[model samples]
Target chain A: MTNEMMMLTNLNCPTCAAKLEKATQALPGMKSARVIFGAGSMNVEYDPNVLSQEKIRTLCKQMGIGVATVVPGPSSDI
Target chain B: MSRYNDWLIRNREKLVIATSGSLIVAAWLLRPLGNTFHFWAMTLAAIIAGYTVAKEAIGRLSTRQFSISLLVTIAAIGAIVIGEAWEAAAVTWLYIFGGFLEGLTLARTRSALRGLVDLMPRTAKIKRGEELVTVSAYEVKAGHVVVVLPGESIPVDGKVVAGRASVDTSSLTGEPLPAEVAVDDTVLSGTICQGGYLEVVAERVGTDTTFSQLVYLVAEAQEQKPKVQRTLDAFAQWYTPAVIMAAALVYLGSRNMHLALTFLVIGCPGALVVAAPVAVVAGLGNSAKHGILIKGGERLERIAKADVVAFDKTGTLTLGQPQVASVTGFELEEERVLSLAAAAELRSEHHLATAILSAAEKRQIEPAPADDWTIEAGLGVVAHGPDGEILVGNRRLLLSRGTDLTPEQAALMVEHEEAGETVAIIALNGQAIGLIGITDPIKPDAFGLVKALKRTGIKTTVMLTGDNPRAAQLVADQLGIDEVRAGLLPEQKVEVIRELQKTGHVVAMVGDGINDAPALAIADVSIAMGSSGTRVAMEASDIALIGDRIGQVPGAIGISRRILGVVRQNVVFAVATVLLLLAGVVLQVIHLGSGMAIHEASVLLVTLNGMRLMK
Candidate 1:
């Protein structure tokens, strides 16, 4: 519900069974993240100048969460 | 060898072979022991079965390492170690047999969906030069022309390139009647060639076939869990850890190995874990039986939580056809006006024009002869008739000819248009004399469905449509829709749904097909008018009404809410029984027999309760 990045990631958990909680610390360039817990998928919105997807996934893994995938929203589509 | 890998391969094969051979051997071996000993064997079978069942279930569950099978296996071993041979064997057999029966029931649930694969044709008849080759559907190529005989299912998605036929697409689309397809009309794989033979050009093959997609949708639906299940999983996330801790405490405090094993076996959470899924599968089965195809548990879950319902206008609410309703003229007979209009509309492809021509044919009004006929795009058709220049279309079309209608006739046309009635104006000798009114009738159950949705406390009911605002509003007004968003493009429909969902209400959008896909996807719950919808629409929707009536929309929502309620009850009942029995074990009042009996009973109880969702 928050204005976060929409994450399209495959869930290591049950499809549609994950409780998606937005990470508290924003990535340097990211505005928000939309994580679908069951699908193990996440969509993150970022300011290209600030943070990278690789950085976000590394941080999330350290936090004990797996980022199965990360894709930008349609607005980012060319 | 590591015990884990050694056990994985060896134990899996052992369990499979043992269960199969034991079933046959037990029937003959247990006869000498009489009914009491047979009961013991059955009990022992239950335990062994429980372990095997738990392993398989855990594989699917993928939630944690703790398994009921391990618990039962350990308990049986402890009983034997304690020298309670008869009791241990009885417990193991009963647990195994119980699990076998449960597995049988769950397997049957899958069979209902699997039966869909039978809908595809086994072979396809492909044309190559002069020879007709009969080959498997998998061998069929895109763009290859395939001949479908009467009563055969089309093996691939293709366009009708050579013939015309009334294909039975109901199996694919849920529409009861056959759809008439002519040259250039695209036919999907899995639709039966009902009344005629036709040559179709295949466009997509194999896995990309419509049948495969339908099967996938059904599977996906079955696997989709409601948000409630997620919450349940979150609970399990902590629950599993807590149970492990509790089991450890009981073992350490009692210093009784048998009691510790009993605790583990009894605390398996088998009934609790299986309860929601079983109910969901059953609910899906019930939906499929009635032509409603729900794609996932999440949709059912969201439908249960929906507080707002948005409807796509073209097909969901009104009969998609805009028909000729009435004809009003002071100077000309209605039939005469209709005949003139029909003659001019005969070559028109416009939906309203087709309606007029069909109406004229139905009324047995022979179209007047015309010459030099020309249809002006977005306006009326002008033709040279025996009565001079005859024009038929809208007021704009008639006015463009410098033809003026009588004040009364003009007023009538204005009134019809204001009321959202599509009227075809007829002009004889460049003078407008009459108006033929057309209206898309509100679906018979539209109002009732809307009212039922209201009773469920869904506050918003918006109708998104490509129709003129007036026409859309008329239907919306009748249906008691909370909002009317008219004249919207397909993308705009999605935008409206997104905007509405932005308000935090769990929104449900009900529509027919491609026009409704984006909107349906954006909404929390997407319902397709399955019975009369396109394959693309059904795929995009999370839920589909097998029947065309809007009434099923509410029925589906009701089913979802009830299923959720039943799931809640099952969880409560299963948990309560476990806690009660464990209390008895702690008090030392219950033995292995009573614990196993209670466990099976609770499982049956929860399973029976879960089946209520099927109703």
Candidate 2:
């Protein structure tokens, strides 16, 4: 599994953030997904064999959230 | 048609607001004519506003995720079915308007990180052989020479090889003073060259530079959820569905579908979900702006609760650099004694050795080459020099080596030690020749720092040091410290911290040396001073004060407390608003439109309240 952090724009509501997180995590080949409401960013872990990063981006766009930038890394948590 | 679709996609929220608002106005204007035109206009307004809400609700429902959008959608549909078109339109419009206001305020809270990103120079001028090539800042590599013109941001962290200029380092160190850089002086990325041209050999590029590390750390810190936020999130997971169940129960019991829908409208809990995280992000960003790197929200909470602060003396309260205060020679000149001591300590790496070598350098006295030099831990040094065997250390070292001191010499050593100066005895061939007093001066602001810590609710301030009791007492007395633990080894300092913790005090250990590492790690919160240039200091502590000033400690703690206050206020305000709105719905005083307006207003209020910590 590979982890990536994507900067999300127009992600304002916490309830919507939670819904987005659940939707992204349910995607095929996904391992985990976390939406940080305060920073307006998302951390996703997925398998390349079953899904592509572009597909994940498309999924988020479908949910009305804009992806500004995507960088590969494990996100740090408090 | 595709261009219009693109415009609609880009300005979806604004279009919804515009269409619904115009239709509502048309409905009011047409009410004077006939009921047909008025009803059609009102229906159009409700549909336009409800369209976006319904789309989000359906999208979320397909993924088995319950959202506030779903609740709002259900309320708007119930209103339209009950022939309350104005209520449906107002509810959707106000919710969208509140979201727009929330987005604006949230952006302001995150502006600190945005400002840092904006400071990065996009392009750099690099020297490629004989040609100067302009490339992206990230493209510059180590060993490449970059030219920075006056009034331009330096593109990479490097050492200057030519020219001189004063560079503004406020973005990095938070200090307004611009540092003067010349040949061999290190300059950081994101600092602006105030004047003159300089060529710098890049040492670190891209994410490896200090500027990048700082930005990355701050961003990560802002994203990390605090314990309170996590708990709230867990609560929200069950709370949303539970509210939906309660609304169903209300409909079954009261047989009032409008009241049940109103219950769903006010039950989103939007404000409570966002309360703590927003405050934490704003607080962390504000602290970073002042050059105080709080590791995370957990550390920030610990700092706010720390009541007892233990400080390591050397390199923390004192300058750590010892200088020769006075020298007394017996049966030899002071210069002769200093020369012999410097010769014996020439190859030694001890702190006292540096003081002696620097003294000899000042006097233009060359130290004789020493052979077979040996160090006694916690004592001093012994070496075989040109002038037979030479020894320099404490009086204990002299006695251990069978070197005898006269009554007068012993008296002088005692007097110096009592006066808070470290005494080093110089012995030649088992005979004491001189006594040198080394003094590590207390930091200029140490007294004020202690006073400030007490004023800021730090109950017990203790000083822990490896120096003798007299020396420690002198420094403690000057600083008004509550207690002093002197003559402590490295492990003993850790023991002191452990003891403080056992007494039920939340402790914070402040230090800057390797010996204080254990104590720093043992404390509830560890803070390192003057950590801008040292990676070890940055990694060793929970909070790293980039500058040498001791005042930043209290400043950091103050920020943490203010953040905690804001978080408490936000949570209380959010929950209270929810409870009050529920009461309003139960009494039939609030309708669907007003409930959403109040709900959105509370979320915006929580966000704006959190942004206050940025100051």
Candidate 3:
């Protein structure tokens, strides 16, 4: 199990924050999820054995959250 | 097909609002066709507009939570059930459009933070023996040698092991000038190595780097609500339930459904919910861009309200590096006195020691190495040389070492002290031999800072230093400070701050050394100036000015005051708009569509007002 914090886009309305949190929490292998709309960031804990950062990124992308932060590549953008 | 699906999902809110809006207009244009078709058209528009609202309400309701979405969804559905399709269409359309506007504003405020994140390099190139290997920046451990070529940003905080470069430190210090770095000079992460091949041994990697810490600090700072935000939050907690009850009472008293539904639309706490957070985010983001880190909104408030600004003289006001201004020899010639003091101070790392050694070097006086060298902390240094035990420090050192100065020597020391020159007494074998007078050059920015603070409504400006009273007074006079309290130890500085508070002044202490840490802790707000190089200074201060420039002091205060002002304006505007709309609805001057339009307009207006806080 590991915990990671990353910036998320489209958290414009504070009301959307709870919905995003619930959607993220319902994902497989996710232990907990919290989206801080004020900070425009999210902190999540999950079992890496059943989930990966890429899978988490995919989940956010599907949920229409903006670009995932901390992706490893030539450019800083994921 | 998948890409199209993704686009649709991303633009779902906008698309739904547009579709529902066009359908409502079409229903009006084609109303002459038939009553049944007209009714169906209006009902279709209502469903399209209410789709997202109902979805959101259900999602939140599943977790046993109630929100504005639930209230909006209930009101929209009730309007449709009561055969008022036009009211249903207007309510859901305005509500979703308002949400879209808020999301856009949030993106604008958070983009300031995004700029910092973009500056971070994801990967670092490290040297493993002879081969250069690319690795994640977080995986690069401390003590590993990281190499950077021309035009690349430094990936870690470390000392330069080899090569020379002029690195642009604008990102960290906000100083546009490129600093020259040779062997042994430390460099921070996020600074671009403009032109050089440098091999730096990493001292701080990943999250420990200054750039990373700044990103983390700023993100957290944006989340910190001001005192007014908390009070408004408490008011909002009771406000939602009160609005629900108000809506029910209005419908029961007048028996009018349209007027009651208008209350639900206007009483959503639309602008009030966004006013404080947007202002706080914009304010913190603006200051962070200028390399000023105000820890949070609470600290931002104290900094804004600080009436008195007390400065630590050495590094904060003066340039901190002193020069050998004049030398006096009592029992020996000046040359002999200089050589004795220089020998004992040659190996010491104190700023005054460098001055003594450099002065001796300029005069062609060679300084031999000394043994039994021990630093006496704040007092000075002691060592044994060819001329027996040599003591070099201030009067406190002499008094503590059981040496008393003659009246003539004491008079000479006062002469230099009165001239704003630091007197370092040199003694050999318990006999006072000479006093080497050194003067630290005051920063040019410090000259008009006092007047600038006054212009910012600072009630008092004070200079607190461990230097002698006469030296401290001379600096205070030059800076035109309101008060001078000198000859104080670290703990004594805290006493001064406490007394300032006792006299009903909210004091802000500015310093950059360990000696000032205690005082910085006790003040209403502590500002650490010139913190790009000092870890302790940043850690001790509530607000850290990354650049050494004293000019930022006023700029920091100006930004804080502007933030406080903007947040206050937002709160007043948010609250007033709500009360005005409520009155308009009671007088029946505004209907459902018009009230929703005015309500959403106020929400968007407050957000835009808050965005103006950004640079």
Q: How far is candidate 3 from the true structure (C-alpha RMSD, Å)?
A: 5.3
Q: After superposition, how far is residue B555 of candidate 2 from its true place, in Å?
A: 2.6
* Candidate 1 per-residue lDDT over residues B457-571, each given as its tens digit: 6777888999888888888887788899999998998888788778888889888876777887788888888642266677667777755668788778877777788888888
Say which candidate scores most in lDDT. Answer: 3
Docking class of 3: acceptable
The lDDT-based order of candidates, best leading, equals 3, 2, 1
Which 10 consecutive positions of candidate 1 chain B have the poorest summed lDDT? B5-14
Give the clashing pairs for model 2.
none
Residue range B1-615, candidate 2, lDDT tens digits: 856754565577777788888988888877888877877777788788878778767776676757676777887788778877777777777767766666676776566766776676778999988898999887799999999999999988899999999999888888899989999899998899999889999998865676766666666676666678777877776777888899999899999998998898788888887798778877787778888988878776789999999999888898888988888898899999999999988889977988888888999999887977989898888899778998888878877987678887788778888888888999999989898899988888676887788778899999999988888899999889989999999999999898889989999989884788888888999998844355566655778876666778888888888888888899999889988998899899987777877888898889888888877
Q: How accurate is candidate 2 locally (lDDT)?
A: 0.81
Error of 2 at B249 (Å): 3.4
Best by TM-score: 3
Candidate 1 structure, TM-score to reference: 0.76
Whichever of 1 and 2 has more TM-score, that candidate is 2
What's the TM-score of chain A alone for every prediction? 0.54, 0.91, 0.79
Q: Between candidates 1 and 2, which one is better according to DockQ? A: 2
Q: Provide candidate 1's TM-score on chain A.
A: 0.54
List DockQ for all candidates. Answer: 0.03, 0.28, 0.33
Q: What value does the lDDT take at residue B510 in candidate 1?
A: 89
